[model samples]
Target: MLNPKWESIIRFKCPDGEVHYGEPTADLKSARVWTGLDVWSLQPTDTTRHVAEILAPYEPTTIIGIGCNYKGHAHETGIPLPNHPIIFRKLPSSITSPTSLVELHGGDVDYENELCFITSQPARNVLQDNALNYILGFTVGNDISSRYWQRKDTSGGQACYAKSFDGFCPIGPKIVSAKALQNFQSLRITTRRDGEVVQNSNTSDMLFGVRQLMAFLTRGTTLPAGTLVLTGTPPGVGSYQTPPRFIKAGEVLECEIEGIGKIQTEFTEVNSKAA
Candidate 1:
């Protein structure tokens, strides 16, 4: 499991033009450099540097997603409450920096603000009671989906293809280590599009909490260290809006989690259709 001593981990480039992993200040504008060779096992140095850019925390070993895990979201989308987590995968290549610019592949694009967690060590058949021990940290995520390919005829009702386009998974701002974050539940998660509030809800709405999700996902499956799991989004996604609004290219979406921090993703068109 991850070293519990870490407060938060952020990857950034300093003004001197050297990239390094460090612990961020409350505002995230500066950081105390981590001098250790292995970033996973963090060791702090006394030196602090001005943060020039904050990058994605880390490239995940695997990106696993859970669907219909929020009660309000289920009701809004007309999807029945699931007895188990609806598992899906997004290719690691789709992972992008916190401030990345995504390319729109089709006209139907939507955003799902999700809370994502990373595992610190290999885990298989982990008990719910001990699930927290295996977690490294938690961060903000935007599970970008393509509605056109999500149809039954195009994707055969599977989520991978419709959601695995490049830059589909934008995670981080920084990772607040699991042990450091006292309360994962009830954290306020909100999203804004061009500074307008779009998705607003608390983590309390999730049908399956972090512990339950970790336990369920590990049953008979050996999740590797660095495995990143997107623990579902709350209600208020673009798809379920009254007019069925979709996110368009060149618009910036900011997803913020109470304790973890915020990430901004801007989607751009690469000869794209209307969204």
Candidate 2:
């Protein structure tokens, strides 16, 4: 059986401008030494600089994004209730960790702080009856978007390009497993920008719960171990606000869930050869 304790993590920033993975430890002295030597000693410290050069956490194999899963978000968008769960994919390259900078382009960026869960096993056609068994954990996510691209239906594709931009999917500080949720059906999701409350809703609003979502996605596709499913976001996404607010450069975005820890990232514009 896997351990039920949730691991809290942060990318350790070294004096040389390098970011290395570090897990929390009971002994502060031991943890600091591990961050400085065990983690960073392995990477090259030669001069390679960008305005921001942080790397995304390296565990998730696939990122599955859910859409309109929250009743409030669905109602606010004026879309009819979905008969089945709506899903999308975030190119693995888009994933970034907490405190990294999310670049905004075309002068507008919107935020959707969301509740996301991870899978423990590889399962195909995961039955709704056994869905909870496959859930390894949950984490914080920011489903950043561009109002113009989404509303105008850019490129005439499926969902929207607003979702596919580089650094658009900001996830994690660490994973918080199912047992931590206490009762998965009752977790709460919250989001804030620069410390002002923007979104507050309960997970109970999910028309399709966590298990159902896993079952729906794996009906035909194989859900590999380490897959992350962003269950969905509530109403109050920046795009839906009156006059439509977008994230400006240097703005802070914070996403959190009751059991899962919070993730904070800043906003910047894309630069050539960006990470």
Candidate 3:
């Protein structure tokens, strides 16, 4: 297992146009990406640059999203708590930068703010007691979806299809090491739409905590290094609203996780005529 003592690790482009990994400065306005180093052997150089030069940490090999892992979220969706963890895969092609514009394909677009973690090593049939050992760090992610395709387009519901659109998964800003957080279960997660708080809840509300989810997911499966896992969203998703509120073009969505960081994304309409 790869564990680092750094407060946060970031992947960014320097003024010289080279990407590197390093910890963020105190105020988080800038970062210093490591030189000639990998996650397992990170060494920061004497260089700090503005946050604008940073990119979306790294390109993950696999992206997994947990469904209805929170009780309140399941209630809001009128779905019963799942006996076992529900997992869905998001294509690597769907990933975009932390501050990039999400092209909204005409449909019921929705936002799900979630706590995401990345693996530091390959894990197969990991036990709950040793699950955290495999995690490198945690970050915030927005699981953008199309409700129409998620629930109505297929015979049942095609979650992967509905959420695998281009630029659907926006994660980052930075990855806070697991060692930096005292209690992973007690952190607060909040989501905002147009500066209005739409979702507010704590990580303690998760039906299956991080440990259980990790152990269950790794059963008979190998989660390779740099694999990202989204822990699911809290209540207050737009699809659950009384009037069913979906994200509109030009709207800004922000996801913040206590002890981690915040990532904001803007929604833009895709011109079908140009497609």
Candidate 4:
């Protein structure tokens, strides 16, 4: 097994205005730049600098999402627990930095706080017991959604199209290596909107855990290295609220996981002409 001992891996802009991928130092305020290296080709280097801004670690080859994978989330949506993971594809273009602005296209824009993992190596027909070996690390992600397009439009109810808007997925502040987590199933996940905690749950409640998801997804498909997987959200999504609470322009949404860091995103309305 290739277990990495990194506290956190990130892509950041240094004070000199150049972007580089690096691992943060013990203080978590400064980073050691991996000069002339891509994230996958990273090697230990002594060059370090103060971070000016944090960016999304890297562009994933593909972004996969699990829907209604939590019991409470299925109940909230009035859908029964799935016999298998409800898989969906999120376009890589929808990805944005942790603190980026998520533009809404006028309808019920909702938030789904999820635990995400990145693949360390290509996997095909991977077994559950060996799935962890293929994992690089984990991070926090928000599966920003547009309910109208998800449920009422011509392409309604299709998760791929409904959740494929620009900036619909905001993930990362950093990636905590898989070796860093003692127990992946025990971590707590929470989502807050405008400072109010809206979703709170534990990974133990996931109907299908990480190992199962990995095995299932790679059955006959090749999961390329650097693939990102959003392991579903828990209950308390806005569309299921009593009066239906939706994300509006200028609102802030925070998605956090106990072991991994949090990702905060600000919502903005998409201009009519731009839409």
Question: Per-residue lDDT tens digits of candidate 3, residues 50-145?
Answer: 765656877886999999999999998888899999999999988877888888863899999999989989999999998888999888889999
Using all chains and alpha carbons, the TM-scores for the candidates as numbered come to: 0.95, 0.80, 0.94, 0.95
> lDDT tens digits, residues 1-275, model 2?
23333343334455567665444343211122123332112232333222232234444658888889899999888899999888777767668766677778544678887878777778788888888788776678888776666654554534446676877788865555566564767877888889988889988999899888888888888888778788888998876788878788888878877765677888876786853
Q: Spell out the clash pairs found in candidate 1.
A: none
TM-score of 2: 0.80
Per-residue lDDT of candidate 4, residues 68-106 (tens digit)? 988899998887788999899999999999989888863
User: How should the candidates be ordered by lDDT, best one leading?
Assistant: 1, 4, 3, 2
Candidate 4 off by > 4 Å? 25-28
- The candidate 1 region of ten consecutive residues with least summed lDDT is 35-44
- Lowest lDDT sum, 10 consecutive residues, model 3, at 32-41
What ranges in model 1 sit over 4 Å off?
271-275
Error of 3 at 84 (Å): 0.6
lDDT of 1 by residue, 222-258 (tens): 9999899998988888888988888887899999999
- The CA lDDT at 84 in model 4 is 94
